[model samples]
Target: MKEIAIAGAGPMGLLLAIRLKQLGYENITLVDARAGTYTRPGILNASIFEELTQLIGLPVDFSDSYHLKDVERSLYKIAESLNIKIMKANFTGFEGKALRVEDEHHDIHILPCDLAIDATGSRRALVNEINRLFPDAFSVQPIADPSHKKHLMAYVKVEEKTDSDPPSTPAPYGFDFMVQKLEELRAMGWKGFVEPGFYALPLAKNKTCFYVEIPENLDASQHEKWLKTVVAFHTGKDNFDYTLLPASRKYGSKPRFLTFIVDPHQVNEAFFQHAQFPCVIPVGDAQIEPDYRIGIGIKSGAYRIKCLLDAMVLEKDQEFHIDFEKYQKELAAAMQMHAAALSKFYQEKQRSYEHYANLLSIYETVIASASMSKQKELQPSFAELIQAYAQSLYDAGNNALESILTSSGDIPLDKHGLIADEKKLEDAIARLIDAYKYAQGDLYTMASLKLNEIAHLYEKLADVFIQRGAYGSSLKCYEKANMIIEKILKDRAESVLIKYKHTQTLHKASRYEDMYDMACQTLSEIKNIGMDPEEKKKFTYKLELNKALALLHILHIRKDLEERDYYEDECNKAIKHVKSSPYLKDKHLLQLTKLLGEIPIESMCNILKDGDKSDLAADKSKRR
Candidate 1:
């Protein structure tokens, strides 16, 4: 590559700059237009950061506990040390292979480069403009606006640590204070503007990161003033202090992060041919920014850039082409997975928030009480420890739930795993249930809702389990789901209908007794429900059919002399019921009649064959 120009110097952009330099591309220019801030304010996945750094042959060593700013700043500094020319210019749009950039002095220039990286966050400034100019480049509109807006971001900077020594837990006290304040802000207009609450990440040992809704029509001064008010409100007491970082104001509206993808067909062809768009590849939020709720923006950007870099390196021997097409498709799929997970993760967060807060509240209460106690050593009961432990699990589960999704929406496994992910879901369900036990009142209600969701998830997991031939685990999942669903639906018609399905499943597995028992119970439940008489009668008839089918299965299983009598009697009874029924389907009645008639002829043949053998025996004896 003769010359490559990259737009934006966030973590992804910075990393791509470093990668290009490592690969020894002669002329490379890295540009950071958005106020030249080293990083966007968000959580960074430190694990992947390490891998990417290693891939680029960069020596950045630290624990996997860095924030967005740390990564971007480090990458930017590394790029500079490698003699990569960095520019602070705003990218207005593109002029063919030439990039149009506006400098700080407001002077515009068309700088030509072989390739350009669009790491311009969610704005996708050049991507949008390029598509407008080249309508045939993509299949459809690439940007997706979220209908249900929950894109509230907050930045929490701690003034000082309680002590110089770092805390043992990854969770910072600032985050705890942030959460508790969110709990209080529900009385304010915070809930109206945000999700149930804000999620917090520590930028440093002393600094925590959060996001919020910036009120409408606020000027720069007013915005800063408002942010200060919010900071004070959250850190007024309990030794928590913070400073709100300025919100990212693009256009007039504070849009939730928009999701984008190049058209699938075009993206798939990016590697083989020198497509026009690869020269202007979009990475990070510019490509597809998932909801803050899903929280994959940082990782998503890193993955896209890494894939591009690898593709370039692999094919470096032959030519200058990169696997941009495959990179875009995989990246798009990853983004969609996050979007799919948003609804479920958001709901779980809402339902489980109370218990999460209560646990924290209880912890503070215990600590405070212990400090005031006369005994030097004070300890909580076994029950209290269990309660806290369970609560912690639920909190972790809620966060992890975002990873479980499949293309067909049937299977649920972690998105990042090489194989089916069971433990993530299993641990979540187990811990949630454990926490649900001690829940009371509002906590109890929320837990019930969450349990219902877990039940649904379990049903999906059971399908995957059965497909994998883990029938024992499948059955256990089914039982758990059935139990939770039954309690939720009670004696309602829906429950009866679900029970009918259970009977069908049992029949499929040849569990005849279980099928018959379930069918009878469902039949009785239908009769007891106060649904319309016609509705009840219809459901009851279906259950009777299921019961008869189970009986036929039972007869087939038996080898005794009584098998025939029992089979005949059950068939006759079922046949009679079919004829008497008002709404019995015609096909079912005809099948029953045909089966009933065959039984008699089969029985006669059995008896006559035995008599013939006996007569032959008698004749032989006389001869002897």
Candidate 2:
């Protein structure tokens, strides 16, 4: 049996052991430097539940322990359900495929294994040992923001409650409330607010965990006063009492210092100046130290374990060199994707907060006015509030567009002769006009601009076609525009803008069949595009008039009965295409509906009973 020794009894180490065991590697040992399990009041976020579930085949249940459940409880439940028994011991040192651990009696136990995983977390001792033993394999760097450390502190105690009392105490835990309180404190010359009412497990009946986070720079003397105020705010004086423990004092120290480093980037800079190992893998915080507030450390640790497992599985069959190269590439890709996602999330959040702040200011002003006797008869209604919110969104969109235009230098621009420069300038101007129109909910303006741009592009193509004396090809461009305008108006029946374009394009295209085809295709395309009833009516009139003329022309050309019958079949197919379209307006589509209705009832019933084979053949021809 393949034996693996994993250091650290934390979630990452435990999860790795469980996964390895499931993969048929059962002889495993989990070692922690501490003598026993370390207990501290820490919260876990719900994001890691999926990862936990995948590692161990179990669904997390949070209803048992905590009254106020969040992400943390979800994590704890998953961890508890793993079923893999944990053994506590101190990790003294390590040798090749062997580790030394001290038991309860202080007797050192040496165990041999196939592999030794350094899941000893962010300990400098383990890192230093690894670097010294394999100098060419490991690298270390200082964590950033080393000075801005603050400890996470929480208090837990049991209290007595009557049967009629609520299961969980009502408390405000949102960051907004904390920020507001902090601002209020800042007004009174205090650096930070005493954040209160953080929810936790109801350890016993009438007992609740009263949690508070204290920053490193808080005044020492004011700490007690702050705690008192927090306790009073969360639990009323009559209902519950408090017990502050000694362990809570340990959390009064500075928080962990974190560093954001890219290992491949370091390698490129030759920071691994004297590395010699076959594979020098850095996992968890050693790889990249993100902010603790984001709870990325746990996520990074779990991800690293999964990556290691993947590499190990691949290496079993593949050459060591190939496996190492593939692993490094995958690692780099994961890091880049993570960085991009994190950056985008924070950027969007900052923008959202700014928008919210502006809305709040406006609301405050309106409320103040309503409170005054000067505005006794005037008060903003619910609809007015909704309108204000929508306007804010529009304003934000406009601001975003303006920022892109002014600051984004990546957008191309030409600077040659006056005529060429003016054309490029016009294109840029048109783009900005479209953006502004979209922000202002001016759909007509957007449609008009798009059609105009398409026309100009097609006009240039037509000019090239004319120079080559390809009259048919030149006419196709005008025909294409005519079709587009027809569909636009058909769909947007009430739109004056689309009607004008449709009329103009239809006037330009000469061929009768081309005009008819354009109208048919336009009707089909309009099913996909947006349009109103009036726009639909205007376009429908244009389409039917063109179709009638085209059918008559085809009849005049094909004088023989058989040939005339073929042309009639083609016209019917075109009408069928418009009727069958998904976007066809039921009311406006009634033109084709009525035409089908006008056919003899017996013939219509026969056609419906025995589907048109000729129509099917025509569809197959179109596909080809």
Name the lDDT value of residue 80 in candidate 2.
42
Tens digits of lDDT, candidate 2, 1-624: 145566665556666766766665546676664413343344455556655666567654443332212233443334345444344666666655466777777888886654555555555334455567766445554333222233324444444443433222434443333333433333333332222223433444444444443444557665654544444444443234455444334445312211122221111111122222112234555454444345565676677566666766523422222244555666666655545544554444333323444444544455464546523422333233333344444345434434433243222223521122334434444443333333334544554544454444445555555566555655655544444444333344333333333333443444555556655665555556566756555565556545644554545444564665566665655455445545555453443333343332222223321234344344446657
Winning candidate number (TM-score): 1
Assess every candidate by TM-score: 0.46, 0.41
Model 2, backbone clash pairs (residues 3+ apart or across chains), number: 20
Model 1 root mean square deviation, Cα atoms: 13.2
Model 1 agreement with the true structure over 1-624: per-residue lDDT tens digits = 456777887767777777767776656787766534544444656665667666667766443456555676677668778888877887887776778898888889777876777777666666666667875453323333332343345555656545432222123335334444444443343322122332356655555655434433344355444444344443344444556544446533322232222111112112211345337777766665555545466666666676677666423432365665666666667656545555455454443544545545654564454445411332333243345445555566655654554555334544542225667666665656655766545555666677676676667666666677666566666776777666555555556655766676676677888887888778767767777788787777777777776765566465463657866565446545654679777666544433333332343223223434354445445557
Off by over 4 Å in 2: 1-3, 33-38, 45-54, 58-63, 66-87, 92-114, 132-151, 156-213, 219-221, 227-300, 314-322, 336-624
**Backbone clash count for every predicted candidate, in the order shown:** 5, 20
| Model 1: residue 549 alpha-carbon error in angstroms | 23
Ten-residue stretch with the least lDDT total in model 1: 264-273
lDDT of 1 at 371: 49
